[model samples]
Target: MLPPDLPPLPALTRAEAELIDCYLEVVDLLGRINPARTEHTYGGLRAAQALVGRAAALRDALAVMHRRGESEVHAPTLARALRVLDGERRAGRLALPPSPGG
Candidate 1:
């Protein structure tokens, strides 16, 4: 059962949902990769490990945000989506993309 004090999760935007879906797909594919089917390269293994760690961090951050009532559920015209992304980035749960001018 959900904790009694926890707030309901914010509804996902289409973009947010799509991002999560794509991220999960990569995570799942890496998880199901057969060692026998892929070349035994340390680089691939390292990347997979990094992705697993990042995915865990992202999941945990999302849960904490939900429980703390720190979500975009009612902000129809504000920064719920940006807030989630920025909060996660600031907390080291996710990385911000490089700037176009950088």
Candidate 2:
């Protein structure tokens, strides 16, 4: 189980933990049976991939914000905002506003 305060991974958010557990179960089963025999049939794998992207973005943002002196009081919320901002920047869909006193 994950810590209670932090936001859950999207795969663990929109779906029950049991669903992810089931996916992991299948993945484990395939790993044990014939690792090369199975392939992802649908978006569960895609969603898993996206979730990894999101978590990576969030982690990078948290590191950046921490370096920029965003205190812990604001870190968690700012982490989420910065993750979204970074996503938009990557997608060429948005620009970040100038920092104060910049």
Candidate 3:
């Protein structure tokens, strides 16, 4: 059996969409580079390197939005979009694991 279809993404301005995509990319790279979760230095190093570019893109996206006068963030709408995009799970990789037994 096939899985259910995902809900449609909320309507967003082009700049807002770009911002969300760039933000998620950076978050995913950071998650991969998280020291507590990474299994190998080389893998984390690669992620960190990629993070430099992703972070730049994220910055650029914000700059574009700001220059376009999108000064106010619609947090509720963006949060809904993030939830639709599995951002919570992707970001969870950044958290430290629970210490042994407590």
Candidate 4:
């Protein structure tokens, strides 16, 4: 059985770690946005659009890392990013948003 608190094994390469950091920053930035403000302010909307775009690029980067046989330590991070992008029309690929009351 896996350790409940353990992260994925086999550590990240320098490049992979950089990508994860970028992904995390964008995710954190989006979390700071207020949905009501985004609907009204130009800057807020643009930030949301940029956040959505970066999430897609991160997905592609994760795919490349997978092809190169890196450890799956970033999987959970990617999943969180996807959920943030979910229901965002600008985000490419199929994304299912979190269910209500979930």
In the range 1-102, model 2's lDDT, one tens digit per residue, is 974564434422212233333334334333333323334544445544555545554455555546656444333543454343343233222233356799
Residue pairs whose backbone atoms clash in candidate 4: none
Could you estimate the TM-score for every candidate? Answer: 0.33, 0.32, 0.95, 0.46
- In model 3, the clashing pairs are none
Give lDDT tens digits, candidate 3, residues 1-102: 999999889999999999999999988988888988888999889988998998888899889999999999999999999999999998898899899989
Model 3: runs farther than 4 Å from truth?
Answer: none
Best by TM-score: 3
What digit string (tens of lDDT, one per residue) describes model 1 on residues 1-102? 964563343576554454454455444445434354356677567757677766766576566657666575434422344444343343332333456799
Please give the RMSD of candidate 3 to the true structure.
0.9
**Which sequence of candidate numbers ranks them by TM-score, best first?**
3, 4, 1, 2
Looking at model 4, how many pairs of residues clash? 0
Which 10-residue window of candidate 3 scores lowest in summed lDDT?
30-39
lDDT of 4 by residue, 1-102 (tens): 964653343355655665655676565546445553243566666767788777777777777777888756666655554444442333321234456799
lDDT of prediction 3: 0.92
Better of 1 and 3 by TM-score: 3
Cα shift from native, residue 5, model 3 (Å):
1.4
Question: What are the candidates' C-alpha RMSDs?
Answer: 13.4, 18.3, 0.9, 9.1
Q: Candidate 1 or 2, higher lDDT?
A: 1
Best by lDDT: 3
